[model samples]
Target chain A: MYRLFILAKCDLGYAEEVGEKVSELEDVSEVYSVTGEYDLLIKVNFDDLQSISDFVQDRLHRVPHLKETQTMMSFRVYGEDIGDFVN
Target chain B: MYRLFILAKCDLGYAEEVGEKVSELEDVSEVYSVTGEYDLLIKVNFDDLQSISDFVQDRLHRVPHLKETQTMMSFRVYGEDIGDFVN
Candidate 1:
């Protein structure tokens, strides 16, 4: 599976709501409100790059309250750290 | 100033510490512990792109505990929302 990271900028005060909405979508593993230029961060896993582009680039951009989004696609993930810890 | 976003993967349970150390740096505007493929998300502003590369790309990765980093440079930011709200 391909893992993608999406940084989304939403209208003020919409981070929580937007995060919630994105998390409910299939393939979206997690979403969180964060402090930064981008208000929300989303992690999605898909079968291919096209699926990520189709699902996140097309559909996610359609979500209301979002003003901008920047997506980073990983070619290869390094390090044995993180993503293994459970809350 | 050029605004850059760095998604960093650190050793398990090191997110908070790494976030703190990066935040204490001069140009780092904000750093946050996040739940996602990346363990931490850092926002930094520099006088130019070179500074971001120097500070975050060079110095940040050298920090212990961090395993990987992906930098995203924004050309133009969109939307009129977020980044304006206060705690």
Candidate 2:
């Protein structure tokens, strides 16, 4: 799987709405409203780079209230603690 | 709960080892080795800002092989998909 970390800047007071929409998109795993240069942090996983490209250009780009985005590709997942939320 | 995203840079070939140690720390939820300016992306949650400060200064600082880190505080969790893995 190919994973990407996307930092999104949204219109003022629109982060929650933008995040909700982004999170519903295919491949989006998590979306958080954050305080910094960007308003949201999004995690997405896809089968290939082509799918990622399509999602970014065709789907993510269509999400309203999003002003800008910066994407970082994840090369590997070294550790994940699912037990934190699971029994 | 307060959440933080940490961007870490590690010494050559030490990301996995550093990530393993970081993941074992209390509050660390995820660690991903990624491309671009930072080597790893870490998600952590704590009860307050003081706890986050202590974790960064006392615990995360002691993780060997980690060169530097940049932390971003999360304001809210707009959306999450645990079902992707839980099912």
Candidate 3:
């Protein structure tokens, strides 16, 4: 699986709304309203790199109030709790 | 509750080992080996900011092979699946 972490900056006071909207998108696994350079943290999983690009471009871009986003790809995962959610 | 996301860099060839070691620490929820500037992405939770500081300074610092870390605090969470694990 290909996992991507997106740090998003939303319009003022729209972080919670944007988080909820983004989390409803397909392949989105988690969404958190965060404090830092960005306003929200989004986790998305897909089967291929192309799907990741499409999701970011076609799906994520459609979310209103999102000002900017920075995406980072995850290469591996290590944790006992991981097995509980990942199949 | 206080949530923190830690971006960690590890010594050469030690990302996976460091991820496992860090994941065992108290409050750590997930650990992922990620690409780009950081080697690992870790999610941790605590009751207060002081606990977060203590975990980073005492617990996380004790883990071997960790070269550097950057921590970001999370303010809120929004998602349907959040109810599954957060109780």
* Candidate number achieving the greatest TM-score relative to the actual structure: 3
Question: For this target, which candidate reaches the highest lDDT against the unseen true structure?
Answer: 3
B1-87 per-residue lDDT for model 1 (tens digits): 456677889898876677767777777665555545777666666777667667965678778898888776644333322332200
**lDDT (tens digit, per residue) of candidate 3 on A14-62:** 8888999998999888888777789988888888888888998999988
Work out the TM-score per prediction. 0.50, 0.86, 0.88
Mind sharing the TM-score for model 2? 0.86
lDDT of 1 at A40: 72
- Per residue, candidate 2 scores C-alpha lDDT tens digits across A48-71 of 787888899999989999999988
Candidate 1, residue A19: the lDDT equals: 71
Error of 1 at A43 (Å): 0.8
For candidate 2, the clash count comes to 0
Give per-residue CA lDDT, model 1, range A1-87, as digits (tens): 566778789898877677767777777765555555787767667776667768966678877788888776644333222332210
With candidate 1 superimposed using the best TM-score fit, by how many Å does residue B87's alpha carbon deviate from the native? 25
Order by DockQ, highest first: 3, 2, 1
DockQ of 3: 0.67
lDDT of 1 at B18: 74
For candidate 3, what is the DockQ-based docking class?
Answer: medium
